[model samples]
Target: MQVIDPVTLDNCADEPIHIPGSIQPHGALLAFDLEGILLGWSANVAQLLQLTPTLNTPLAALALPAEVSQAASECLDSVEDGEAPVTALEVTFGAVRFDCIVHAYHARLIIEFERRDTPSDAVAAFALKAHAAIDRLRRQKSIDALLQLATEQVRAITGFDRVMAYRFHQDDSGDVTAEARRDDLEPYLHRRYPASDIPAQARRLYTINTLRLIADIHYTPSPLVGRAGDVPLDLSHSVLRSVSPIHIEYLQNMGVGASMSVSIVVAGRLWGLLACHHMAPLQVPYSVRMAADVMAQVLASLVQSMEARANALLVEQSAEVRTRLMETLLHQDEPARALLAHAPGVCQSLQAEALIVTEYGKLVVHGDIDPELAARMVASLPAHGQDMVERSAVGDWPEALRPALAPWAGLLALRFDPATDGWLLALRREQIHTIRWAGRPDKVIRTGPMGPRLTPRGSFDEWRQMVRERAVPWAAAERLAASQLLGEMHRASVAKHVETDRARAQLLAMLGHDLRGPLHSINMAATVLQHGGAASTMSTRIQASSTRMERLISQVLDMSRINGGLGLGLTRGPVDLVPLLHDLLDEARTAHPELRIDASMPAALVAEVDGDRLVQVVSNLVSNARHHGDHGEPIELMLDERDGKVLLEVRNTAPAIPAGLLPTLYSPLKHASVGNVRNRGGLGLGLHIAQEIVQQHGGEIVYRYAASQVVFAVTLPRA
Candidate 1:
């Protein structure tokens, strides 16, 4: 808006620069340098020195008048005296109002702007007021008082009609906690509005950012064909002067003409909104809202501190109460029901209203004496067997509970153990507020010895009501209390289960060990006789049968030991396996005289292994072969090395081990049909131990069957 005259040749040469504002007759100033260069120019400089490009342009193009150019030239020339010129002017850029100031200190000039008209001392005065008020607030300890102060400060500073703390509830309802209104406006304190009035998207957007300003929510947005600017007019921000259409529609629906929502962050979370509302249309400049944002940030930490202190106090109280109750209830020798039956008395002693205990409605008990009325009240509660969970199938708490406890009154329901389906109720009595049980937080009762006020037993009706209430069944708190009480009782009732299992295990272990000693000696004697028996038929048959009986006893003992985790110790050493195999062959020759032995092992197979255990595994396999295999064919033993592991195998020419028995060959002893000597002989411990020992040394025992031949192979890590 400023116009400049052209600079003549003489003026240009005499002055290194003629700043646009100095030569142009506008409300702005400019400074030029001695190098015939315009260092900085304001809006007024546009008349004398026109800029080619708006941003970062040179200052030589304005058609300045000869006299104005001469004045600029003189100013530039005087730079030898360290003096610079300044000018002020009004300018507009793409519809933006910018008041400009230009000043040259040395080589470079500075351009400053005021987007809006300002009173010089308004800012400094505001700082003093805000600082003093905030300093006073900093010394405040009460949250309610601080909230009041902050609302007042915001209303005064912003000149808004209404400034309030709007708290968002889980149900999407909001309550105006602190409200400050203009002198003529009606009060909006303690008013609540459903959050439904603010669409879901609005809440989402509010939380997404810290500050939102709809200077005039009713403002229509100007459509742009690709607007170009650092900022637009928005409900949130205005790079250019256009608001979002969707937001405008949303605001209209909410009945708000103009609004600015400042996020109230507490405990590192968006607690709610500090909403400034104006019923009449109003426009707030960007600078004002930005200041509000800064102020909000200042108060955030203070609010956080207050919330933390309150939460800490709550936790301390809960812990103290829980400790005391647990000491009284959990470890008591008496039954839980008996212990909890006294809860109503406890509540009375604590000076509470209508002491009620609910175990999710499973167990309900009340210190209240209106037994019949209490029963009806509890029966209608959203309670089942758990304290906290209202019956989902039924109506909600406020709805169902409202009509239920209309006879009692109090505030602050003291709770305990919600996780385990139990809650203790100790309602505060000093409060005029009525805390009808969940069914009805407003339930009222007379104030006598047995009633809510707990006044002196002046009349007999109070005592009668109390006595009558004691007989009421299915009370919500009583039922819930009973449910939790029952859970505790059930647990306490069966607490000795583990000890019983341990006793059984011990018995098995003792019987197995005690009974095995005699069986072993009998088997040894029978075995010696079987191998060396003469032609005495009776003596030989007796010994053979006795040996089989001994085997059965050993099987039972082995199974008992294995099941009880009585591990057998084994010795590890280098064994010349060729001789051990030879000895085993000799034993098989004596046991299964008809069984032919085929050996393909080396003359000397040395292995770092438990030689005795290996001997047992081999012996068991031989026994299995003699009993089930070689029904008419001979058995064979093969030893070799494969994949760096020593292998020992015993094969039988029978029907590849009864398929049904092969799978369970090394499993625990079942109540199998005892008939053959082999069947009755062992409890499959040899194969079990063999597998275990080899596995201990990183080895395994496996079976490979083909045709009528069954092969039992043991693979061990080779040394």
Candidate 2:
């Protein structure tokens, strides 16, 4: 057969066209023209179902799947009907996906086979043809068509069951805005999934990687990382570790055998999920998966481009929410509690509840402090209990920090600004309880086991983890303002802490100077009474007063050292606790013999602490109880061993720390209960001094109020 080359650059992309390798060994060519003409034979024989140039030459036929043939015929019909000469059709051949574009000019059809792969190269070509389509959209100025065209492009290139652009809702759940898939996947057309379905651990990993593929739930899972030959190994570029096992189990439990997902981002924010599923184990070739990824990118870009205007609307809508919150915070008449009661909507706007505002230890604005779950968590970490705190397991946080907040069940600390001497904390249900992702067809980029390939996966945990890295969705106009607010809050908190500490040091310095003179005078008086003609009873009373003055001086001095940044010193060595406690107890009782004392410690208990500082810590606590808890009750000092640490606790029953004075005890500044009916007077530095001394010995002293009784506990590392 003499013939000029029919394949050209027009027949394929940049590369040379790959003609279906020679169909016949004898070289009697069988080729069709765009006009459906078999040039080797007369045109009259072209309509024959099976024909050969020579009657003796038997026709060899290739069996094509029914879907492919029908798709080809439809494309040809469109051409004959005076439509485009070549029309693209999406079709399935067994488990494989294909893109078939049919051509008809003569009496014969020339169907081109472009596998659902090389979507990047394919997009380059389509962008050229679809430039007009894109222009149509630009003219229409309609986001719907923009999304629709992008979806069709992805479907044509991926051949997945169903592809969708699912948007995240105010709740964790999402809605499907665009859908493109095989007709068989009608169930996922506009479906939704609960955010609870995707756990927190899974969300955090999504931002680092792309491409979530669950070939089959029944498929044995190999280690996501590490070398295992014959497993398509690529440690540096693997996608398994990026995927979460928990989510894989979730998909398996959900009866989904296979799943693949990608993320769609709009304006640098995670917009939605592009999800795919298969009923059985599915293994897509790298080339095919990559093609889908490229196609998804184009779709995501188009959608994002079209939604640029709508983003402005979203920003405007949030104005009301922001104003309400600002109003609540700035309200002059209403306290934070009243604000919460009258403007619940405002609190929700900040995604917080239980906001607390304090100037030093005094509560100026407080909505909810003792949140049911937050209380338990606070108790567990007493050292952190006093700070303006919030925690959440849903909405946006990492998985590593979940266990610490589990007891709180999504109670989160809002950004707190001490500059205003106020805090914004939240105690609310987790955001995951409200929102979910259906699927996002536009996102072709993600980070994970897939190594920045795609998102949406069989492992729900892995998928959610990736989502955690999602950027905040505040619009550009709002972002600057939001950042300013967050910064202001942080700066305020730090400024307040500094001011409180500075004032506290000044008071202690003055007290240290003033009290020393009187303290020395009292000691001289006591000494004279002891040896003078004065009675022994008079000597004891004088000595007691002298000791009280000494204690007040020591409290003042400890505060000065801590405030001056002297910090703690280390003298690491084994030290016996029994002798330590007994000696300190003797000195304490000598100062106030009338106060009862009890000590419990193991005979051989020892720890690593500064001996002199430890002594001071114990003595200070005893002295504090002697003065504060003057109810004539025995003060209990409990020492026990737990978790390899020696615990020393001082217990006393007395008037509570005047409620409002609780926090200022540690604050450098002295805080008095504003209008407490109970008359209590003290600089509130006893516990602060004791805490510093204990810490210098590498220990911690904590105080807890139990109704009328206040317990001060100190723990040191056991050696």
Best by TM-score: 1
lDDT of 1 by residue, 343-368 (tens): 54444333344554543233344554
Model 1 — which ten-residue stretch has the worst lDDT?
A: 462-471
Error at 330, model 2, angstroms: 17
User: Candidate 1: where is the Cα deviation over 4 Å?
Assistant: 1-115, 119-121, 227-257, 279-285, 335-364, 369-394, 397-719
Candidate 1 lDDT at 296 equals 69
List all candidate RMSDs to the true structure. 27.7, 19.9
Worst 10 residues of 2 by lDDT: 19-28
The residue ranges of model 2 lying beyond 4 angstroms of the native Cα positions read: 1-150, 153-486, 501-513, 516-557, 672-683, 695-699, 705-708
TM-score for all models, in order of appearance? 0.40, 0.37
